[model samples]
Target: MSNIPPAGMSAAEWQTRQELAACYRLAWHFRFTDLIYTHITARVPGEDGHFLINPYGLSWDEITASSLVKIDVDGNKVADSDYSVNPAGFTIHSAIHRTSHDAAWIMHTHTRAGVAVSSLEAGLLPLNQIALQFHGRIAYHDYEGIALDLGERERIVASLGDKPVLVLRNHGLLTTGATAASMFNTMFYMERACEIQVATLSMGQPLRKVPADVADHVATQYQSSMGEEDDVLLEWAAHLRLLEKIAPDYRD
Candidate 1:
């Protein structure tokens, strides 16, 4: 599609599209994506019940700011675009965004490590600092085949509750935040935690659990360290710079 920003679009909405596009590109760069499978969606600024998601069939790296399709909570396109949205994939995201005011951005992935950890009977063990960040803030939703059925939306939302991270049992991982950067930040760590857990477990050696109290304390410490300035924004800025050096076309 056209790279130029659409006429009459607010500066805020345009920025949101760019940030979401950058998130997709970054996921591709970091190998967080599974071909064109997973989806990342951002709520349209100042627009209630609307979101921006990658067009169906586009590889994450092939996605651009202008290529993102705007759709309502029902997964119906709200804006004109050559590409169509993935209704099945949007079901998970739409369910969360519909129920949670804080879920301004939603990220889902099917990474190998994430899926491996999801299949475990004891999900996301507190094996390290990265995993500890989700000590009491993670939820698990049992897999129910593909997410094409709209009836599964309520169950997914119920399973997620108010947690920022959700480990789709035997499926993959999902993360939500009030900002695209924040969501991306959570996914980055969550994926790393899964990767570490899988690697550690593969050794078949006894694993040491970071004590519950310590995990709680560390989670609180991490939250305290995030002051007025948003860590995600800072991290996203650095990532954009890296993308500029490599794949700047995502901004198109």
Candidate 2:
């Protein structure tokens, strides 16, 4: 068993715990979770260069705030936890965190839609509103088996190249943001984009792609719209409320 402090034991830590746990349940609610495969991490509040991640082997539906494991930039589990962190998962997340300091939260998942889109030769197309928003930002990292090798970190980081979202070719999806909610929201939209692409492709007809110039304009517009702090907080709170209604156990 892990010696996890009770939720609300520390105001900031508890808040991080709530947000991280809510992210897990919300991932589950959105059908983004797969057993213990995905991970959602939050930078420790007021703790420099440290963060918390799901204890390896725990399903998203069963994760609670306190049950999460604490780790440093090197992926070392400094906290008192019976479980170990997944090396492959840590390799991907730690690399991104080290590169993107503003990314306080990171989400990675392997949904069917995500993998399906990743296997496509065209990658993400500018065929719809959701797809066009990712026109110039999405990155792709060719899969090298499981992400267990630390050497892959350099390549993964190189491939992401300042982008907020990455599609692990032959694998799944990833998104980084300033908050767990924001990261999850990004993944939600990215996966939905992939799902939409797959559904559209299955129609056996040509896709109605938007013009490159228009896609660029819309992408810039979304980037601006996401800049407001109030908007981010409001969306975060709304997601938390939804999680509370759907999976109250995440707060336990």
Q: Can you give the TM-score per candidate against the true fold?
A: 0.95, 0.91
Best by lDDT: 1
Q: What range of 10 consecutive residues in model 2 has the weakest lDDT sum?
A: 1-10
Instruction: Encode model 1's per-residue lDDT on 24-50: one tens digit a residue.
Output: 999999999988887999989889999
Q: Against the unseen true structure, what C-alpha lDDT does each candidate score?
A: 0.89, 0.83
Q: How high is the lDDT of residue 172 in model 2?
A: 88
How good is model 2 by TM-score? Answer: 0.91
Question: Which regions of candidate 1 fall more than 4 Å away from where they truly are?
Answer: 1-4, 226-229
lDDT of 1 at 208: 92
